[model samples]
Target: MPTAEEIRRRIIEHGLSIRDRVIATMPQRYSLMVEQIRSIARSYRGDFDTFLTNLSSIKGLDLLVIYTALLAVLSKHKSLSDEEILKIGDSFDRHIYDVFSASKARRALEEAGVEKEIANDVISGVVKALNLINNKYNSPYLWIAEQRRIERFENSVREVLFRNEGGNRVGRGVKLFLRLFIHDTNIPLAVRIAYTQENKKYILHGDMYTALVTLRSGAFEDVASITAERVKARVAKRLLCEAKEGGARCKDVVMRLESIRGLVRYVGKISGDPIVYERGAYDIGYRYCRDLKCEACPINDVCKRYTFIKLK
Candidate 1:
């Protein structure tokens, strides 16, 4: 029966505790490295944004560096279980495969004389470059191997997405992918560190809502965004319908909406644009709970919200 404020407090406490645990478990050398990396990364936030916006201009070597940096930071985690490490590896492999595949597709289109129809010049360039690299290597086997690796990675991503847990799947996925990519021996250490820091900043501040909004607005070159109004309206409708079906009081539904509104406000303060954040938060919350009360239900017992009637 935690009040809304109490639940918020708990979330903050839990987040802080988790951050501390991650920091505590890091090796001394890694801890020092992370600090240095963070300082360098702080200076490049704007540059990073620009890079994301102009991802096509990024060379294969630059991409490789980003992957390496991410892996280095992930290596500092002392508590990652064997399975977890494997999972991370799988995710990273998938991300790499995706890049490779896109590059290959672009090449095929260009070879077929259809590059102009593709519209995305960056994608076209990447594909053409990948094709050139393949030709230079004189190894179709490499492209084949990349395709197989991407398939495996995609399966892992699907499993992570569908799992029924409130745990931070996206965060975990990002962390795992970063580590493997950065640690890859083929990539340079400096590039790996640089890319890892850039990704870390995105994860630390970017929530599902922010990601969706960015996608909708088409502001980001790589990732997509969604409209704030559409997201909020959808979530509000779902919550209201759920409450109505569950025989909950109108006042309770109103309170629930209010609680969601509060979350939106908080996210806005942290992320900028309260309206977009609020809509995104509501969408996430609704989707997280689906048709049932989650473990983190703020108004469970006293609220008398139930989809199924009890047999007294």
Candidate 2:
């Protein structure tokens, strides 16, 4: 098992990685974007304490679409540009998918001069997959002790993709939905006690959830598999629960987030960033695993699964 120190280092490192990308265009205006969002949250509620009262009330489709698009791109061994995403959504919002087909979707992209074979990234594939999941389970409050129902939902996602000619990898799609819902704090507990017991030869296989926990845990030198790290998260979750962080959800939220820095100055306390593992796990896939090569990944040195990228 990896020590907590290693994991904490990785969390900071991954946070830095994301921070770098989100503000790459400016003169690297460095800030933990959370602090900024927190500031917005604070002022909106007239104070931090009041914000927690309406944490779930401030809702909209804007954050949902952005999050869903990220998941869609990471769902396969493919990537999508912002323009490609806009075209797909625009086509749909304009009802162009009324005659939806691979060719028709392809034509729309072709008309836009997208020369790549983007059937999966564009109209008929990932877009449709996302819409299906959204329509079937469009809950801002998605969660389950209903393992059978969740399993049925997962199976239906696969069935939808099979019929729509989307990528047939059910786990990837299911995990992506889980990531998003958990991210928005819909189902936090599932991610913890999260991975299956069976270990894969590589981290990305059956253990992607814990693999993420390991990777986001910047100091992940000692862990054997993602499963090991997940075990760690389960332990951490208990510590959090015992500590009573963020009330029942183990993460307090603010309708209006303020920046008081320490726990005392704020409106409420939260469990250390809700579902950081889920968000980070999918991020590793989206950012690194798609075009996976040892040279391209920053944590490549520590990931034992790959020995040589430039194999002759």
- CA lDDT of each candidate? 0.33, 0.36
State how far residue 278 of model 2 sits from its true place (Å). 5.5
Candidate 1 error regions (>4 Å): 1-5, 16-61, 64-263, 266-288, 291-293, 296-312
The list of candidate 2 runs beyond 4 A from truth reads 1-5, 12-77, 81-108, 111-152, 162-174, 185-275, 281-312
Q: What is the lDDT of residue 230 in candidate 1?
A: 40
My TM-score estimates for the predictions, one after another, are: 0.27, 0.36
Compare the candidates by lDDT and give the number of the best one. Answer: 2
Deviation in angstroms for 109 in model 2? 3.6
Residue-level lDDT for 269 in candidate 1: 41
lDDT by residue for model 2 (36-136), tens = 33333434424333433333443432233333433344445334344554554454334332233455555544554555554435444545654665576
Best by TM-score: 2
Clashes of each: 18, 13
Q: What is the lDDT of candidate 1?
A: 0.33
